[model samples]
Target chain A: MRYEEFKEGIRDGIPICLGYISVSVAFGMTAVLSGIPVWAAVLISLTNVTSAGQFAGINLLVAQGTYLELALTTLIINIRYFLMSLSVSQKVEENMGMGKRLATAFGITDEIFAVSMQRKKRLSAPYMAGLILTPVLGWTGGTLIGATATSLMPPILSASLGIALYGMFIAIIIPPARIHRSVLYAVLLAVAASCCFYYLPGLKKLSGGWSIIIITVAVSALMAWKFPVSPEDEEDE
Target chain B: MEQIRIGYLLGGIAVMAAVTYIIRMLPMAIFRKKIDNVFIQSFLYYVPYTVLGAMTFPAIFYSTQSVPPAAAGCAAAVVLAYRGKGLLIVAVGAAAAVFAVQLLMNIIIV
Candidate 1:
């Protein structure tokens, strides 16, 4: 890759890397508290790059959660990435190969996808590489730091750090909500649906894994079908 | 016991990695051609938000044992987020609120 392009990639990825640092630190702290080894937590942050699923998974592991439980839960949690990947694939430069595509896909978090989608041109491989790499490092590094420091930190402090993931989520949902009425609607609908799931009898008993997947798919799909992105905008992308 | 648990953790990671890679990579690998259909494109575009909403919403309230405090905190978060407060502020605020409320409730009830 050209030096200029490489530099540009780093420049573009700054926000994502910064966000990862905070969120990953929280994940790491939680992992340590959950009785996972520091290295194991780091490995999870490095490999998974998913906050919610990792948090849920760690809790389950501590409880001696079954394999089926873990599998089902994580699957439901990460089901969104599948859809994100599908949309992001469209942004991949047409000439990009399978290996490049796969590598880029690894970095396809909500934040990265949002930023990449806003870019003017099709995302370059070097740009995507830069976007994914720093976040991976930050997440892994943060987890390692949190794990090692868990002993030094008090329980209240550790519990407080758990909020960082939610903070990140809030950060994600707010930006679009501010600009678009549709996004606001989407957030409200999601929140309302979630409450229903919690209150309803049979639904409450459903596994956390499946509940998230089903709710997200149903609500988001309904909205999308109702208010599809205009053809003109699609052409612009 | 520790060794067996460690084995399970590692095994879980391996399995997770494999499944995640496949789900992530399969679409790009299989569909090399441009997706020109409007309906399909729209479906793909909306799917992520749906999935994310589903994933995040339930966790906000039900993940914890006590519903009221967690729910209150999450509700505060949603309102703050709606108002365009920064994410860090909302998160820290909500969590602190939950922790405090729960602590107070415990003290009062006991």
Candidate 2:
């Protein structure tokens, strides 16, 4: 029974694995473009299976920002995982022990969480493990390829690839923004705030790490208060 | 290779990995019940979108080392994504747009 569940999880995870490889390739390319070594980029993906958080973290690394900045930015960018962990915790078997819970928790990404939550039965440790396995491997392996291959690519090609991350970011937020007024407001406000941090006199001095943290926290907080998601809207996701 | 300290890069990666792990782990190990606070729930719900949005703009404009190519890419992405194209499509479309614009600019310059 456990093996069956595990196989099912792996089957469900294949599409997510494919998507992850593409995104992580961009990540690897971006890291190398920013002067990070190829091996280091792959290591980051291996250790941290996150997209935005790693992107923000590497930006901090390149800028030689303070450790405090790196930790806080990663924390803020990844805070949504906490909610997913909590929500997914409920769907897991009630008797699930702390050890298994901890192990599965490490794999709770936005995509994994979405897929697992859609399951009709309680999630088991093996299932979560299987679901996480391919995506993790794909992400790390894609990073390896991207980082190594980037040096061989022409400057024009690499330069164009640089826009791929932002393009993916747009793709993530746009659909939610279309369906929800609150999300739309939050995104616009974030963009405006982000621009101010870059172009405004006093704010321009803030490093990219700190600027992202402040804008994300302030904009999200304000939007949450002004337009708390209706329960119905939450169900749509 | 000597441009950056390997120790420094490892330290930064460690911090990121640790923080991300703890966030994912803490909630699952401790919370058996759903968070009932509407404000907190809503805040968490919107956090990812805000972070992605903030990270993308202005920064994206500088992505290709020039505003025109980046802007063209961003516009292409926005249009395709708004039309409900999948992530791979939007990303590749934007990159293609940037490449085309850069090629055009190169032609005009030479």
The number of the candidate with the highest TM-score is 1
lDDT of 1 by residue, A71-92 (tens): 7777766766676777788877
Residues B1-110, candidate 2: write the lDDT tens digits.
Answer: 33779999999889999999999999888876656778877776777777777878788899895999999999999999999987668888999999999999999999
**C-alpha lDDT of residue A11 in model 1:** 67
Clashes of each: 2, 0
Give the alpha carbon lDDT tens digit for every residue of A1-237 in model 2.
Answer: 999989988987775676677668788989999999988999999989998788887888999999999999888778767766866876788888889999899899877775675566778988998999988998999899888886455778778877876787787789878987888999999999999999999989776766776776798789889888765567666
In model 2, the clashing pairs are none
- As for candidate 1, its clashing pairs are A216-B50, A216-B54
Looking at model 2, give its docking quality level.
medium
Cα lDDT for residue A73, candidate 1 = 70
